[model samples]
Target: MALAPRHLISLSDLDDGVLDEVLELSARLKRRTGRGELAGKTIGMLFFRGSLRTRASLETAVLQLGGSVVNLTAMSDFWELEEREGSVMDGRAPEHIKDAAAVLSRYVHALAIRPAPLGNSWDVDRRDERIRAWAKYATVPVMNMESSLWHPLQALADVLTLKERLGDPRGKELAITWVHSPTPASPSAVHSLLHAALRFGMRVRLAHPAGFELDGGVLSEAEDLARASGGTLRRELSLEEAVRGARVVYARSWQSLETYGNPTLTASQRSRHIGWRIDEKLLASGQDAYLMHAMPVRRNVEVTDEVLDGPRSLLYEQAANRLPTQMALLVNLLR
Candidate 1:
């Protein structure tokens, strides 16, 4: 009998105490570097899509903690994987997810996966079938760099950034607004933040267009947490309403689940809200509002260069926090 290995698949996966511990450790690691706790460890990173921050940050984090990494692009480095339960192997993809995951687990101390959400099945993709398939078969702990539905590592960094800037995240007016993007983005980041904010008892104001709302299940859970934590998680259709007097204005844009898998429709839906882009006017709502984006932004579209380079923006710090934050996560999981 052995203790089950820990996996961070979602922010919701971390309880309040564990989240607090991770944030505190992240702060410490940022102030004073880690002790190379994973001197002999190896991390196998598989990306189903392209990434700059997630991969580089994790690679750096592993090395800083004295661990090595094996980077693999699923679509290029190896055979394409089939995630279905029982599928005939006659197509281009040769390897099944089960075999790929189980074998990878044997070769590395831990497995981290970032999968794309491009598929016709909202039901399957929304539930993150590929990541789940890997987790089901892998022998070692599985961490999510980013999945179809969530990005816990990014969310964790965001919380660290907020705590560092605000000192105390509780009882603060936090605005989570939606901006425009060329393509529909994943709602997981905003969802993850809402979960963290509510758990910290912050006043969370989610502002998005009519069809750009977040997942109902995530919202429901956050609402419950808010009630219990003495915080509020309410939706606001107007950005002004959401950011007014807020301490932090997190500008984000997510795909319209209503038109998921339909690019034309989703694009059309997103186009109507181009004015939703965050500019200086929006920042005026909270002069000291710490502008935050998840990165890989569509500058001048989702956010203006003015706001991004302004004194209040935490973009660079937010990005830098990813390294130490992930170092904390790896040390906690792999140490």
Candidate 2:
């Protein structure tokens, strides 16, 4: 990218000013919609993993902005693009990310990429080698739909949900609590949640088991943002304590970093956390907190039907905001 083209690689990629501007733009576009300024623009949508909302929201967002999408999904048209440095081309993968990235940059006005199939290697997974390679080589602006490290699009919707519900996010009591799940999950949503909250100076309480702490680097960033915003960030062991008197309770599940990228160990660790499910009883422990989650949730696993289907649940609104939030972002990049 020349002198830094805009890329939503992570929440940090966009400063608070720009991010909040995007949110405002999203709200405006949602109310009125595009003027078709980007009618002939095309965005390359490459999904190395399966997606429901991200794929649909992005394509729809582009279309709404009068831009089209060239979609690519893994296994169907997606193939392995080697990302390693100076690797021999004798492996099963025939193409390199550099060449593929160059082509993608040339064809589309901008590009959005999802995570590729991750192997058993925890080290490789955390590195996000594939997306990094794409960003390094692609001249066009890159968008991160979701990656092993973060899910910024979901996080943007989350902040939009919070803003829509709470008015101003500044100084609000927000709690991010870990809940039960069928499998170990990525920390993407949680990461973005903290970044968004702290960016706006919201008091953020993070509750999780001993093994389920977030990445240290990401935690440090949240701490810095909180400090800068005059917001407080507390890591609490008690779920009830974390949500106490909070306005919003973000219930989500993430793989334990202690056993991160290790399925067997992650399962073993969460086995002790079966009681961590979020429900009415838990939400009531707080001050009539609004419940939020980036779904499709394992209803009974992460939360009971009552809480998920209840009035406090903001899941659908959050899902709905994904469309406009992405539409604003697409226009920003394409224009």
Candidate 3:
């Protein structure tokens, strides 16, 4: 048997071989969810942020494993702790992250946390960094629900959906569209999804409006990975042009990095680019294009109801895979 990952933070943290193992294990566990393979285990969930998929997925995965989950939400009292200065004991909140980590470790077999980034733009990458830093002191293995920088678990489920429909993604045209949003949330899903696809040699197109472009160095990094893996990367301003005949279209709203942590500017800046919204017209360009999103999609904004509920939408699968992928991650780390 292969070794398991003690904690999952970012896809970039795992090599291709390890990632493949996770995908395979997740598929198996998904098929045998009620088999009691991991009975009597417990998972502790701490969210300094809000989540729908992450929370539900982890809860379900642990239960399927015959384990239990404990959930913690960021509270006003916790925010007060952030204000305290000096010694760990002096924080405004009653508990420090280090203390919280150790305490949670005592009762749970593994730890899962979702910390929202500080800036107005949701920097999923940065969230990964913060959570990992806390994990350094945690005795138990850590699982990332969604960090500012990457959503590895989410990506795992996403690719699983792709593999189900289109076998291997290498050389397949996939579009990661930057849909219009009222705010910029760092676009972690876009960054990580593309990062994963590129690593496996898939041709990827990133479509977004001007000034709404992704991090400058990200493409170059993905390009380097693609050059070695037989995939291609393209960036465009036209949604229809990018989606034309594409095999998969992953849509999500993200805050502009240019706007960074400024919420005031995010809305105004993104509105000018509202033309990027995904609708039936965009899908017309690619009749066979498969539609995807990480969920919590804003209706009439990032996607239309027709398209979201359409024949091509693989969103439920994307959402459902969260449990098995996370279980694979948890099992790898804790087992």
Candidate 4:
């Protein structure tokens, strides 16, 4: 494999060998957190929107590796600097992203950013295109915190979790099913999980309502990957049918790509919005299977409090692995 230097902007960016290396290295580094592996190194983190796990986990992970962090609420200072009436972005704004990226590159080992795409709108290609545009001129490698289309870091952590739980995933049945949510900005967890599960050679099933299919290209890519890995990708509208004989049933919500761009009236149609809920019936189908979900989940919507807190739930383990998985990513990209 042609390994390059820096950045983990997408899951597709890393192949199997590179991905495994990062996972192994992360385990080793986490065991030696105080040894100062990156004592003098610093990383810059910027967020254009809100965050919980993505923010806290990366900060903790980098610190454990003996690295320091510089965090910026980008949309705040960056926005003020850009929209100031007469200040001239040339002035106190001090620098544009181009300049900031270049200067920061000289100080920090890498930069991670989260630019949340508009809610209920799933235009990943557009979002990623813009990110790539900025990255083209960046001085250092850029790790995408979460982009319009993909959340590679989350995917990495998830893959590691699967590996730790079920050993090799080569023939394991893994279902990436869409659960219920009030809005479309439910997080790109399922998209990333589908891609990761397929790429890691797991037999994958995608269950979602009729009009709420995943991105066309992402689905196609996953299909190709699944075929190549000796796994299969099957889509089903019935959650029970999808979860049958699965080792893991992962649930998440995403905007219906078919309804993208019409934010005003999409939710007005109540029937469309409720097509993705995870009630008891869905869980009962996979009674013996492990339940997985990326956190910040809605209380009564996507999953009931009972299921989320139940013994079958592995949500906590999934969240905990974010630290080590990220440490692995940082080690490979920076160290």
Residues 203-271, candidate 3: write the lDDT tens digits: 888888877777666677888888889898988647887898898998888877777776677677877
In the order shown, what is each candidate's alpha-carbon RMSD?
A: 1.4, 1.6, 3.1, 4.0
lDDT digits (tens) for residues 13-63 of candidate 2: 887677877899988877897789579899999988779988888888888
Q: How displaced is residue 51 in candidate 3, in Å?
A: 1.3
The Cα local distance difference test for each model comes to 0.85, 0.85, 0.77, 0.75
TM-score, candidate number 1: 0.96
lDDT order of candidates, best first? 1, 2, 3, 4
- What's the lDDT of the predicted structure labeled candidate 1? 0.85
Model 1, runs deviating above 4 Å: none
For model 4, how does the per-residue alpha-carbon lDDT over 132-204 read when each residue is reduced to its tens digit? 6446556667888888877888888788878878888888988788776765454356777888888778888
Runs of candidate 2 exceeding 4 Å displacement: 1-4, 117-123
- Output the lDDT of residue 51, model 2: 91
Q: Is candidate 3 or candidate 4 better by lDDT?
A: 3
Worst 10-residue lDDT window for candidate 1 reads 116-125
Candidate 3 segments whose C-alpha is farther than 4 A from its true place:
1-5, 76-91, 120-129
